[model samples]
Structures are given as structure tokens and as C-alpha cells.
Target: MAGDAYEVLLTSTARKDLDKRLRKSPAKKDKVAKAVKRMREFGPTYPSFNTHQEKRTSRADDPTYISYVEHNTHGAWRMYWKYAQDKIVVLYIGPHP
Candidate 1:
């Protein structure tokens, strides 16, 4: 069931990657913002988007599940995240790399 509204966070790595991408492609800022808004409004499992689980476990050291939000753009972008408790912590955001 949908619990209380979940909080979305970005890890340092994610923040760094996003910053770089935004700097290089200012046009992507709006898309990134929309993606984040969707995450907040619909949580990590939004049905409209195809989100996939990541094989690399978690960076938080706890039992974690990794996932991503795919974005269509000139260079395909993805928003990676880790789910735990009531938060979705973004781990990365950039062109598939």
C-alpha cells in the first residue's frame, strides 16, 4: 500500500553527475525536474514509466534495492535510485554510461 508521502533524496554521486549533465546540456534541466517531480508524486514504482532494478546492490550498506527511471532524449538519460524505508535516494542521473 502507499504509505505516507515518500521523500526523495540524491546522493553525492548523483548530485555530482546531475550537475555535470545540467552544465553540459542546459536543456535537460526541465526534463530532470519533471522526472524528479514524478518520483515525488508517484514514488519509485510509477506505472507510466519503465523503471528497472540495478544489479549493484546499494551504497548505504543496508539491504537495499536499486532502480532507475528511463528518459528519452538526444542521448538517453536515466535516474538511478535506491529504495529503503520511506525514501527514494537518487544515486545517479546522466546519459547511459
Candidate 2:
């Protein structure tokens, strides 16, 4: 749907985390990008992932209420994020933290 789209942004910590992680494993970049695209096109759900594939976080516990995305080859990598007014602010990257 037209209104469900969102733009994704990374926080400073998330940016640093991504850079560090990607530096070690550049191949995972495409998977990360796909997750971002899903977030943008679907606003966290339109890809209709199972709970294992995506979930929610909240500002009370974390900086997100909606979530990041995907499983990883090396480990459980993810993005914690929240959305408002067409923006998905990625609060963190890598692991469940």
C-alpha cells in the first residue's frame, strides 16, 4: 500500500556497529539491505515474516517499538527500530541488545 512505506535511519551506535560488523563480513551486506527494503516497503510487516524473522522492541526497554530484521550466517544479527510519520529509526544493530 502507498501509505505503509517508510524510510529507515540508523542511530550513531547502530551505524558504528554496522560498520564494524560489515568490515569483518562484507557478504552480509545484501541481506541487511533486503531487510531494510522490507522495512521500507512493508513498515515492518508486509513481508509477513514469522515471529522469528521479525519482532518488536519498545523505547521503554530499547529505542524501538517495531523491530529490525533477518537471521544471519554467523550469528543472530538484527536491527532494533521504531517508526513514525514515514520514518523507521534504527536504534541498534547486531544481536538482541
Best by lDDT: 1
| Candidate achieving the largest TM-score | 1
| lDDT score, candidate 1, position 14 | 79
**Predicted candidate 2, C-alpha RMSD:** 4.5
lDDT of 1 by residue, 1-97 (tens): 2443668888988798789879998987887887788788777677745775555664445544433344455567777776656678887787766
TM-score, each model?
0.74, 0.66
| Candidate 1 residue runs with Cα over 4 Å from true position | 1-4, 56-74
Pairs clashing within candidate 1: none
lDDT, candidate 2, 1-97, per-residue tens: 3554677788888899898988897876886777767776766665433222233433453344534355433466676665555677876666555
